[model samples]
Target: MLEEEYQKRRVLPRHLRKQTEPERPFSYEIRPATLEDIPDIREIYNYYVRNSVVTFDEKAWSHKRWREKFEHLQKLGLPFLVAVAPTGQVLGYALVSPWASKSAYRYTVENSVYLGQAATGKGLGRALLEALIEASEQIGLRQLVAVISDKGAEASIALHEKLGFEEVGRMGKVGYKFDRWLGTIYLQKQLNPRKKPGILKRMLGAGASEE
Candidate 1:
């Protein structure tokens, strides 16, 4: 889908494509996450879990669980990235995980980006999401989905829209948080449209069996 849209605009030369990469804010750096970053990531996420509707979890994640989650993404070769300040503090993180457990759903992934409470409104969320989208495409993912909460997070919703995600569906009052019912909004961005392979191509790909 992105490819189709790109073609509609004038095509950019290969070298020029890199120049079009989104510029990151100067004070912090975005990079692939390390195991050592897990503690900070968890602290940031736990703050939301305890104080906001951004996460549905009632309890904070345990250290063991956090380590396992990071390892799971690493084993799958999906991108898990963090934004860090020069002070070596983790400001935020973004990651892509398998959308579903089924084999046929392998090419599609769901994304999540969370910021430290203090880091909101800094354009860091946009920067983190853009990095995730690029990494997903490089790893040959075809679709990226964001399951955002429809509470007070217009900033998150707007960021998703700015990055090409469209509202695909919404579940009304499906979540209960902070003494009120909350809803979920699903937004999706098609990274690369999957093409149907011709019979010859399929045969070659499958090691051509006798008919």
Candidate 2:
């Protein structure tokens, strides 16, 4: 009789079997990242590095490394944003870096978004990416690219697609991590044209005029 009851429960429709209280809503605020947020951001990224193939980095980064990256992005005048809970906890971060060092690629950037383990699957990634796109556009960036690991990152691919990022290319078996081969999927999004000069262009113009 017990065996028969177990089988019956297993065959029942998912919704008809049982129900529990829905999860309470989560709240967070997105804003520009400050130096104080570096430790939390580094921790969030290192978790994936140590445990998952989402990032190809095999070693965890130190505080000094994160601080250097933060300062570099500040010098480049790029957007580095963070999501914070009302209780003042950093939940996630997103940022854009120069796509290429060439002067011709100044209008393009590569975007990265990482959320805390507890912050996943709550629509937080979507919010962070959207904010990054808007911020990049405001800074006169014309193109944004995302390089995502092809395996174990279906949700990331889907999120980028839903946000209008097109799959432009793929490179297979380029990265090896966790004792297995991994690949990358390249996604690109074109932003609206800017009406005025961006920070980089204005700075260059100032230097030229001074000379």
Candidate 3:
């Protein structure tokens, strides 16, 4: 399905089209990534980290470090996605990662969404997250986790719930950034329960669905 869609150049489902800009004012392409976007990604993500509780880390991540993290996620069989404007400006990114280092946790992954300020409230985060779920399922992942920040990110939290994720746990005062404490909200979604694929199995010509 993913390959067939990619070949046709369409990956989005209709219901997910909540905030596409007018007249396709916000046309975007979701493709495999390159190293070039890391700087822009860092700039966009650090903005939220510095200003909001969307993330708990206070320190700005360097592009190199971001690139390395991408490597790890890819190795974990997760694809990193970016939503870009028609002009190629990156609006946001989403990805899935292993929930734990143990082999037993391999079927369980975590999800994250980070968007630019200008992209907020425009449904870019939703798009990014939805894309990640599709990619995660295409790769045969079984579970997804969302670790949310708590200066109270109700909308972010609510979006996950609306998407079929259930709150599994919350840790109070486990995160300290921006001068105070932030709670960690853990949510999970089961992708599938039967088969699981490794990174190599999710490559372009891999098992992602040629339908």
Candidate 4:
């Protein structure tokens, strides 16, 4: 469907329709991402880059770029997770990134979740999201944000809202794809609120970490 059609109807076309029930029960596991998973992760991401407005990236990222991105996430101690099916295939992945560079925003993180074409509506995205939420909370993050494309993103928006995210903001015509203007929506979920620690307390703890 055209991006304009989606905007007009507020419904994903039948081809993009999500699964209402699993074809069969299959066990999957979510765990910290490994370097070995980069190729599969890149494949899934590049699919969206090429075919959908779900991402604003016009070109697929190079493998080197992906490697650097993953390494950076590792250095920040942020979580990168992969969902593996019973057959050992990667079903999907999720990760967090800095919302901004300033130290004052240290407790806030931007989240990304992607599922392989085969994995949607089977609850894999939900599983990855739940795991990410728990992991982020345990690591001291106080807020999680999702910046999602407004086109071809009904399922994504619904999923975040179901997970307690509130639509905090929207930016219209911020992107162009398929020869049409696209928009962006921001959703935020507050985890646990806490007072910022003083400098002396931060110096004595691992409180300087960004994740």
Q: What is the lDDT of residue 180 in candidate 4?
A: 90
The sequence of per-residue lDDT tens digits that candidate 1 reaches over residues 160-185 is 99999999999999999789999999
Q: Give lDDT: candidate 2, residue 54.
A: 88
lDDT per residue for candidate 3 within 47-166, as digits (tens), equals 876788778777888888898987766655577888877788887888776676545566667887877777788777777787788887776778889988866688899889988899
Give TM-scores for every candidate, taking all chains together and pairing residue i with residue i. 0.78, 0.84, 0.78, 0.80
Per-residue CA lDDT of candidate 4, range 1-211, in tens? 9999879799768899896975667678899998888888999999999999999999898888889988877767777999998787888999988787656776788999999998888888888999999888777778899999998999999999999999999999999988999999999999863333231133223334434
How many residue pairs clash (N, CA or C atoms closer than 3 angstroms) in each of the candidate models, in the order given? 0, 0, 2, 0
* Candidates 2 and 3 compared by lDDT, better number: 2
Compute the lDDT of residue 61 as modeled in candidate 4: 89
Q: Which stretches of candidate 2 lie over 4 Å from their true place?
A: 1-24, 202-211
* Higher-scoring candidate on lDDT, 1 or 3: 1
lDDT of candidate 1 at residue 202, scale 0 to 100: 25
Q: How accurate is candidate 3 locally (lDDT)?
A: 0.75
lDDT of 3 at 138: 79
Between candidates 3 and 4, the TM-score winner = 4
For candidate 2, the 10 contiguous residues with the lowest summed lDDT are 202-211
lDDT of each: 0.83, 0.89, 0.75, 0.85
* Model 4: CA > 4 A from native: 1-24, 193-211
lDDT of 2 by residue, 1-211 (tens): 6998989877968877678889777999999999999889999999999999989999999999999888878877889999999888999999998887666677788999999988999999999999999998888888999999999999999999999999999999999998899999999999975545455684333212322
